[model samples]
Target: MADTPQANPQTARVLSVSELNRMARDILERNFPLFWVSGEISNMTRAASGHWYFSLKDSGAQVRCVMFRGRNSYLDWVPKEGDKVEARATVTLYEARGDFQLTIEFLQRAGLGALFEAFEKLKQKLQAEGLFDETRKRAIPAFPKQIGIVTSADAAALHDVLTTLRRRMPGIPVVIYPTPVQGKGAANLIANAIETASRRAECDVLIVCRGGGSIEDLWQFNEEIVARAIVNCSMPVISGVGHETDFTIADFAADRRAPTPTAAAEMASPNREALLNTLLQQQQSLQRSMSYKLNRYMQQLDFLARRLLSPAQQLTHKQESLAQLGTRLQNSMLQLLGRQQEKLLRLSLNLQHLNPNAVLNRGYALVQTRDGAIVRASSQIAAGDPVNLRFAEGSAEADIRSTAKPD
Candidate 1:
């Protein structure tokens, strides 16, 4: 056969099973990028190493799937058999087993893709409008006078919240604005209830709450009207809807968010025991302060009492001082009278030395004419018609018979 195309050894290369499988895996991975695949989970197996091995099946065909522990651990809910799911995965071949498989990175419920898309779109729109701004948020009151709840009257969440409130603080009054929290037109009902509560302005704080459920069931809380109602509420609103992992648009608009219905009640009411303990401590402090002040005042009063004098004692002291002053005044007057008497005696002795009557008493006679003129010398009496001589005790009148000269 024309030497039948002799085999070219260099052109034709042989591949081992391992090499072939590896080439196939690389080709599959390169060709099929990571994309979402929707199917019902079947033959689910949770390996001891925390990895998940399962088969994704549809009406026609099924494919082996694997999710590593690191990827699956982040899911809030565990995947069970026959659960409809959507996995984001890349097609690949297991080299060791030489089998086609998909490596899953992320997963979620199947129909939730559209809901998630709508949620994201709305969130972006609201966030851009500053509806979720922190500055717009209000602070919850520390001591709410009255609490209002907007929820279904028969809901288990209501019971939990009421129980919590009763246990923590029985004195606080609770008002219920009953409404449907789910089903058709539930959003409008919830909004109306919130508006009514705001209009009444009866409660210091409003709690809008419901129990946990699937996203579709809790979708009312995600409605724009519910969110706007919460934001526009006159009283501070607390949103407590769904489980801890679940989130709704109302949570963002509310002034505060609680993880559960009971937690919301706890946030609204203060602990009775704690308030009592604080009041007791304050009372004790006031008593101690008053007691200290009273003791100080009492001691001051005692000291004043020791220094104070009775009215009778004060009168006696005044009387003694007046007696001493009177005695001093009497002595001063007596001394002045004695000095005056001595001065008078000295003046009398001086008067006696200069007295003309004393000279007459010493046997000196005074001569005078008839007209009472005194004659000092015999010449003064010469040829006088009449003359008088006066002694110390008597005066005599006589006529001059003759004039005489005396040696």
Candidate 2:
């Protein structure tokens, strides 16, 4: 340990190692003030307690740094390895080890001002144009004959949207209007594709989308030409560009904005499972209606046969015919009785289904007031109120008791 100098050992007082480190820590903290430091971050570690540990280094040297959770939690941007950053920190020494370090208070990127300014300026200009008016937005067709898509031919967004559409409603035809979604002249290409789809009028609705990227990479979707093209389109337009957090100018101008391309495809089509269930219900209802009608007609035919001949005709063949008619009448009465018994069985089952006795057969009991109003909640009765409990086997009266509210 480095300590105070003593020329004569006999006359000097010795200090412990702890005392030396304490003096060094005090001197370092007292001499240096909090200031800004610029460097590339490396060897970053985040603890379970939310504290961050890292080394900030330039070409020639490196220094240990820490940003406590309380200070760093409010920052919008997260710093990572190899990122050039400027941190405002306090220069201090760890009292235990006597090692130098900086305690970071704030952090930021080097060049965010210009892009932020451009984004704000463009947003204001578009708002003034009133291109995003709610009245101008059209409703998408619930069941479109054809769907059109405008995006890069090789984008991952195309694959996601196509897969969702195929799974939801494969019978609906899809039309692809390929365009360059980035780089030079991408905005103009997107605008022209919109215009082309409008003139053809082959599609019921159109989807314009792209994969997620940084502000510079997604700038094409934020351009003025693309927003105007969406407004001029004859068909309703949907904007599904980037991830859920990403937004673009085209999103405001379109009829609807979906967070992702897969969600956009889902919004465009109806679920197949629900449709199949509805068809099945309709079929069963039709069969029941037809059966009832056929039974009614057979009963009318038997009545007409009985009316065509009378039992008073005293001829051998006539008597035989009358006997036959009597047998048919007996058979019809038996058939009607069988149908009535079947209906009674169905009614019995329905009544049993609605009865609350089955519930009480289990361990549950019903509490009611003395006048017989069933208690549904603990709040309905106060503490020390007299009540009766009716069990599945028998009824019992209970005196005043304490009540507790449900958690």
- The per-model lDDT (C-alpha) reads 0.91, 0.86
Query: Roughly what TM-score does model 2 have, to 2 decimal places?
Result: 0.51
Q: How high is each candidate's TM-score?
A: 0.57, 0.51
Model 1 residue 4 CA deviation (Å) reads: 34
Runs off by more than 4 Å, candidate 2: 1-43, 46-79, 85-110, 281-407
Tens digit of per-residue lDDT, candidate 1, span 128-246: 88878889988888888999999999999999999999999998999999999999999999999999999999999999999987788889998889988998899999999987777
Candidate 1: segments with Cα more than 4 A from true spot: 1-78, 86-107, 306-407
| Per-residue lDDT over 1-407 for candidate 2, one digit per residue giving the tens place of the 0 to 100 score | 89997578668767678888888778877887888888899999999999999989999999999999998775645789999987889887777776788999877665645765776777788788888888888998989999999999999999999999889888999999999999989999999999999999899999999888666677888888999999999999999988776778889889999988998888777767667887888888889999999889989999897766554544767779889999999999899999999999999898877667777888667889988999898788887788899887788887756778778
Q: Name the weakest run of 10 consecutive residues (lDDT summed) in model 2.
A: 307-316
